[model samples]
Target: MKDDCPWFLGYSGGKDSSALLKLVIIALSELTSYHKEITVIYCDTGVENPVITDYVYQTFENLKSECLKLCLPIKYKIAVPKLDDRFFVKVIGRGYPTPTNIFRWCTDKMRINPVKQIIDVHPKATVLLGIRNGESKQRDRTISKHSKSEYYLSQSGSKRNQIFSPIINHSIKDIWSTLKFNNFPKSIDSQKLGELYKDAGSECPVYRELPGKSCGSSRFGCWTCTVVRKDKSISKMIENGYSQLTYLHEFRNWIAEFRDNTEYRCAQRRNGQIGLGPITLEGRKVILDKLLDVELKSGIALLQKEELIRIKELWQSDLKNPNYIEKTAHSRVVKVKTHPKPPI
Candidate 1:
């Protein structure tokens, strides 16, 4: 509740976050006359697009310079998710399946955990989020819930070290307008950022099911995201001549093809009943075997290497029990171009 409590600004290097940062800085400058300390936090997922990472660094530098000019005590911190702690690690290493829409597991592990740790360290801080109502229906629900909490908690919850979204009420148009009005700091490469957004065909793959709902800003996301059906941001990189991203694009396809594999999935539900649908474990396993073949050719592991080894081990163990493995693995239809055979 104290005004002196530090502020944690969550900057994801996206348009919303960038705009929020600018607004937060503007507000802090006015409040600095009264002595306020604001710190910026960027959760690094290690899988952020390179361009996004560059912009984040550049923007931080610009903010630092501005703080120095104004004699403010705002600091910047970056947090990263460990590779061993990723979804692949769990799926490949521990025999957990990839997170699905109904059972989304990546968010809590990757996105929320890293940032929450930083927030927990500074319990007496006002967290600055970059949620804009225009982003999505879910965002609207989140903002509405927080707004209600603000009133019940008192003082728009501003007096408490509560979450504050400065631009929550603003529309997407308003964000661009504000940035344009101020000629946005040179630290951000607006042109390239614009291009990235235009090409970003999907949303952050942290939360499952919503493909094309997230965009790759500059940083902080899982390197292997199968949830995103089309990774336009990575594709953009390839389009712009960043050939390394080609592997990423191919990897996504490999995962997609593998998701339907029967050999890789269980025939019976965890409850031990053969599912009653055309989409049975047998079918899934068959698809998975074909997918595995493609993945082998592609050399992209959907799960981590350790996870894969464990899965294979499980398959071996399951084989001992005839009813367990059941040879659920099946083949998929592969189109092959053929030439006329010579007469025998």
Candidate 2:
């Protein structure tokens, strides 16, 4: 028999998500006849580290294939934002500045909105989030607020969708205990994930920053993230022998540098405030050129073909507009190491 309410687990290829995935499987497995569907959704932000991206796909594939062989009623897919809403298009085509902590717009447009759409379509579904109390005080508060019920309801249109967090109050030690008890998905590196957490480092619009500490060894976010003073994850990865990510670190730094330079930004904000708006046309082009060069050298397609196509179209359209202006361009070269093969 099928349960009326399906479970939607959000997997971000991180430690919390991995542990949550294991718990969900163990729970379902215990109820041998539980035939209702469980869907796992992965939001690929296109700008993810190539190595991380590869791991995510490979792991998901292994899980899917294994589930089929085991005859487990599980379904999974990678969710992607529309082409126009993708990271590269918004930056190069729309000339939007890279996201910052003050006005971090990418989370809503590229990550949350797509998942919201899923919720709207799948009524009565319980979305499983992998949030742990040890991560932040804000998270602790959210868990406390929702503690009264096993299923926390969300208003999506006319229907009420439920939110469930199995490990909301779990500390790092508690989480490891559960993982040790359950049979983890084959692709997950349980030992490495545990060690990474020992070293250092989302929800209803999760504050990118945690409560007590700033980002450290566990910050596995976009290589292009400029919201903080630095993206220590990519830096750590490079130091740990992932030399391929060195160019990304430099590219992200360049974006931060360019944003601070008045010459590469608009004279006025969209609201006419005495501040910058989108990045200048010339600067956007420079970024695109450098990105393409990196793609060629690294042997991995950095920006999608559709993003480039739309960027060219948008650039042309912007040129025809009388209000648009072009700033001076500068010559530069991006340095990158060659990868033996694409990180597929």
Candidate 3:
């Protein structure tokens, strides 16, 4: 590795990312402090599971503090989407329909773009990840396309970077076993993972198990993902005793279910393309209402203060659109509480 070339690790807080994190830490620990130009980053979509968000925050603190004690240059960073591009702003403010596989507009905004932007800042560097062959057939195929050279140049029109994966050939068992032999305090809760696996009952999901379906016994993707048919992984956590997250799961499911109801959407898209879109302003208020109620009941804020501020601004802006019809479409309110939020 080049002495000054920084390395960026993509962390998702799932098993694969956790393993990769440990591997990078171990590698950097072996090198002299002068050669340790490594940066580990997590792309936070803002709407991630509260448990996961909390875990990652604390874990980063721990890793940073430990590296400081060792006098190492390993740094931990978090990449977040721009405010207006955040998930809630796009959904409630702009009224984007819940993302489908065909319309996954959130991916680039919430995940990829932020990471790429980080890479672009370093002029040229190495990006590391935990992607492995046995994880999926498609992933394996993609990995095969790259050269076996120690490094592969990843570039864009404006910037160039390198990509490397030390654990490309590691199997599922190998990953777990390696961790067993070289564990640092685990980033995720082992007890919670065990509970999730037990809650999964008969079979366990592996890697990506189709949208809306649970991917594994203890997966940790964004809490707001509507792509999967069932966020079984998070649901399992709730079942196993993380009641605070239940309302989050409910809200996520509701958003997905609510997106397709023609009664709520505008007759045309923002571009007049005659397509499905976000619900009405009144409908959006209903979502906001439930979200607030959930926040009050769970004592965990689902929407950040900044997000609420943005949504309010968007609502006011929407009222000014040439298409705004206050009389018919904007007058509705939550006439009655839909469901009492569960006891905290």
Evaluated with TM-score, which candidate comes out highest? 2
lDDT at 287, model 3: 77
Q: Is candidate 2 or candidate 3 better by lDDT?
A: 2
Q: What tens-digit string does per-residue lDDT give for candidate 3 at 1-344?
A: 45677778777665566677777777766776465377887878787778767777887887777778877677887888888889888887776787876677776677777777777778767777676665556545555655354543322324366566677677767766655667554444445344434433211111112223233223455677787767787877887788998888888889888888766776556665555545777677777788788889889866778888898888777665665432212333323122232111
Residue range 272-302, candidate 1, lDDT tens digits = 5764112322333443455456456645443
Specify the poorest-scoring 10-residue window by lDDT in model 1. 335-344
**Can you give the lDDT of residue 74 in candidate 3?**
75
Give the per-residue Cα lDDT of candidate 1 at 245: 52
Worst 10 residues of 3 by lDDT: 201-210
Best by lDDT: 2
TM-score of each: 0.67, 0.84, 0.83
Q: List residue ranges in candidate 3 displaced over 4 A.
A: 146-159, 183-218, 323-344
Separate clash counts for every candidate: 20, 0, 8
In candidate 3, position 134 carries an lDDT of 54
State residue 289's C-alpha deviation in candidate 1, in Å.
17
